[model samples]
Structures are given as structure tokens and as C-alpha cells.
Target: MESQQEIKVIKSSGKRAKFSLTKLRSSLKRCGADDHMIDKIVNSVRDELYQGISTKEIYNRAYAMLKKEKHVYASKYKLKKAIYELGPTGFPFEKFVSTILNYSGYKVVLDQQVEGKCVTHEIDVVATKNEKQILVECKFHSEEGRNCDVKIPLYIHSRFQDILLQSTAEETKPQECWVVTNTRFTKDALQYGSCVGLYLLSWDYPINDGLKDRIDRLGLYPITVLSLLSNREKQFLLSRNVVPCRQLIGDQFYLDHLGVSQERQEKIMTEINLLANL
Candidate 1:
């Protein structure tokens, strides 16, 4: 019979080793496992693994271990918990709104809280362009469920009132309200939004196309260009006293005239290139 150490080494080597129960047992032991934990981990790994598992298979095994036993070790449970905590589903709803608005030549302000009668509400993102403010509310849902009918209308009504009050006498009133949801809205919600001139944006709209076209025709390049700027670049611009311009111009003129100073323009291009590489 092979020595335990030799068996351990052979079982744990190569991509093919991932399928071996002997390898899992050895790994659990190496990690300082008690017998009960070793058995549990080995069984879990054995059940989930097949031939040709990669090194990154740890995550898959850890996730499966957590789901199998509700009362699993904290370390195992954390593997799945961390996924939900850091998942795009949690906060990227807001990010998605910002991306679309930035593409469409609008400046985004995030998480602005508004106080209203009988309730206090928060707007996920509010976009300003050419003196026209567009209110955006972002929702992330597991499915296209009933909130489309109930929550969306109530949300629109509340935002409509608050936006009206927030407008200054000189500033142009918000021309439209936007609800950007991860899931598609029901038929009734779409009709309601259309009736009130609320622009509903969804995943179906190509982010680059909508933005580029608007920038081309309306000379809304400032909005489109600023949208492309990184959070750091935007901050740098603000620190230097750059502000959003409302003047109407063609795309080519806006790019040549107002996009940036020669030095700052080079910096912006470098940043965009780096982000593209990433």
C-alpha cells in the first residue's frame, strides 16, 4: 500500500486531482480541520466535483458547502454571504443609472434625499443637462413582479412634486422624469410613464448609441464627454472650477471649444485609454 504522504501528494497534484475525495480530505487536514469538519468538507467537495476541476474550484466548493448546511461553519457561510454583499445586484442599479445619464449628456448627482409630506424619500440619481433636470429612480428586483404597477407610480408622483418645488425661478424646470429599472416594467406602468412624459430607460437601450447620437445632433458633447470621465477626473475638474455649460452648440464645436484645455485634454484621453485597457 502507498504511504499516506505519497497518496496525499498524488491526490492533490494536477487539475485532475480536484475530483479525488482523497485530495479534499488531505486539504481539510492541512487546513487544521477536526475529524467532523474534515468529513463534512470532503463529502461536500466529493459531491460537487467532477474530472478536470480548476484551482478556482475552491469558490464553487465553498458555495456548495454553505448551501448544503444552513448551520455550516462561519468561514464557509461567509463565502456565499460575501457574494451577496459585494454583488452588482445590490448597488449597481444606481451605477447603471449614472452610466446611462452620463452617456446621454447629463451630469449625475447620487443619493439625494428629499423630504415630503407624510414621508421622506431618496432619489437614486438626478441628472442635469442644459438646465433641464431629469429625476431618475433605480430599482433592482428578482423578477418583473407586481411593484411595477404599485411602487413605480407612487414613486413618480412623489418625485414630480419634490422636483417642482426644488426648481429655482431662473433654472428651467425638469423636462422629464426617468425610472430606470433592471427588470422591464409592466404594460400599465409604461403607459403611465408615457402619459406623464416620464422617460423610461432599460437595458434594451444601447448606452453608447443613445449618448453618441444626442451628442452629435444637439452638440450635447459636454454631457456625453463628462459622462465618459472617471470619478477621479470629474473630481479633478470640479476642484479646478469647471462647471456644466448649458449653451447649445454642435458636437464638433463643443469638442474643440469647451471639452478641455490642451493639457487637461491629454490627461482625459490617457485616463480613458487606461479604463479601456482595464
Candidate 2:
């Protein structure tokens, strides 16, 4: 049966878009939901649809059904949401980005101050490998539907230029400056970044080499994505600087810190290892 309803739905950005079945299928598939489950969830979700339905509710319903089928799938489905949980502070997000780069074999430094031509600039992450250095700025948003606008890259690039100038004046190799976000970028932001030679990376930019791609490539799912973990427990792990699920690998001691029962730890470990599968 097809839904007879047609309505503009609200997005996390508060923008309205026509409901898309293809989009629903793609997202469910991307999260490892099979055809049968996707149909069930989509049909269930569509039946609940009304004028001005928020995508958040659609996702919640789909996720609830997905989790009911397989908890691991729920973990995979919440990757974007997990990124959001990385902050009200950008510290954990910077570390999260640094950890991702580190897995790709880069040496990373976090929260360092480097001198620019005009003044000192506090860089979020400094990554070096094979004598090439890259300065990364991480912008984290706690809420969904936020984007890195052109003004962001414009501001960061000016500081990068100043730093680059000073580094060049010192007769040393200069660094590349990059702005990274846990969300998407506006069209103007992408244009400004490319036009200025400032590298920009976000949830799904730069073609196949965006933040989400890298995480999937490395199985570096964050601890926040653990479905069974409470928000308090997740925050506790983040406070201790334990970000990636891989970090807790073979270290049952951290589970001890959370007071997880030995039996519960085993189940949690099972979910953690499932994330590493791809």
C-alpha cells in the first residue's frame, strides 16, 4: 500500500522538504538495514506521517524498529547523532578527529598555540607525518542541522594566512590549515574554502574522503554510539578521554569504572566488536 499523504516535512535545520521515500530507503540501507526491515520501518513510519512531521520523529521510529531487530544496527544508524553527542565543548570532538587521523598514521597534537604574523593562534589539532604538517580546526555542534558557513572558513583562513606568512618568514616549512566539522558545509563555505586553497572537511564533503568515510574506513566508531550505554556513562568515558570504541578494546577495566557487571561487559564488548566489522 502507498501513503496517500503528501506534506512538507520539517528538517533539523527547520527547513521544510517534501517527504522522500527514496531517501528513507537509502538511509536505512546505509545503516545496514535489510530490504525487509527497511520496508517494515518505512511503511510503519509513513503510516504515522502527517502535515509538518519532523524528520527527527521519522528517524526515531525507524531507529526504534531497527534496534528491536538488531541492536548493532542501531549503533550504526546513530553515527551522526553520536557525533552530535561529542560536544557542547569541542574538546572531545577535536580529540575524536585527532584519533581518526592518528589511526591513519598521522602524529597529532591537540590544543596548541602557534605564532602567527599578527599574534598567537590556538590551533585545535596539529597533525604531522612524513614531514608534512596540517593544522586542523574542529567545529562541533551539539544540535543537528547546523552547517559551517562561509564566514567560518573566511575567519579561519585569514588566521591560517597569517601563520603561514610567519612560518615562511622563519625559513621553515609552512603548514596546511584545514577546517573540519561534524556536520555539513554550506555551498558558499565550500566555494570559499576551495577558492582560498584552505582545505575543508565535514560529515560528507570532499567526495569520498569526508569525516564519515574515514570513520567507516577505520571502524573508528565513537563510544557515544554504544546503544546500551547511558548518556551519563558515555559522558563519563568522554570525560576520561575515551572516545573511540576501539580504545576500550581488551580493556575491561574501563567497564569496571562504569560498574558494568561482568555479564553486561561481555555483551557491550560484543556490540563494540560488531562496529569494527566495517
Tens digits of per-residue lDDT for model 2 on 147-184?
88999999999888888878864335445788999999
TM-scores of the models, in the order given: 0.40, 0.94
Q: Global CA lDDT of candidate 1, please?
A: 0.48
Q: Which candidate number maximizes TM-score? A: 2
- What is the Cα-based TM-score of model 1? 0.40
User: After best superposition, candidate 1 residue 7: deviation in angstroms?
Assistant: 51
Q: What is the per-residue lDDT of model 1 for residues 50-142, given as tens digits with 9 covering 90 to 100? A: 444454465457545533443222222222122122223435436534754676678998888755444566777878988877777776553
Where does the lowest 10-residue lDDT sum fall in candidate 1? 78-87
Position 88, candidate 1: lDDT? 34
List the pairs of residues colliding in candidate 1: 105-223
Estimate every model's Cα lDDT from 0 to 1: 0.48, 0.88
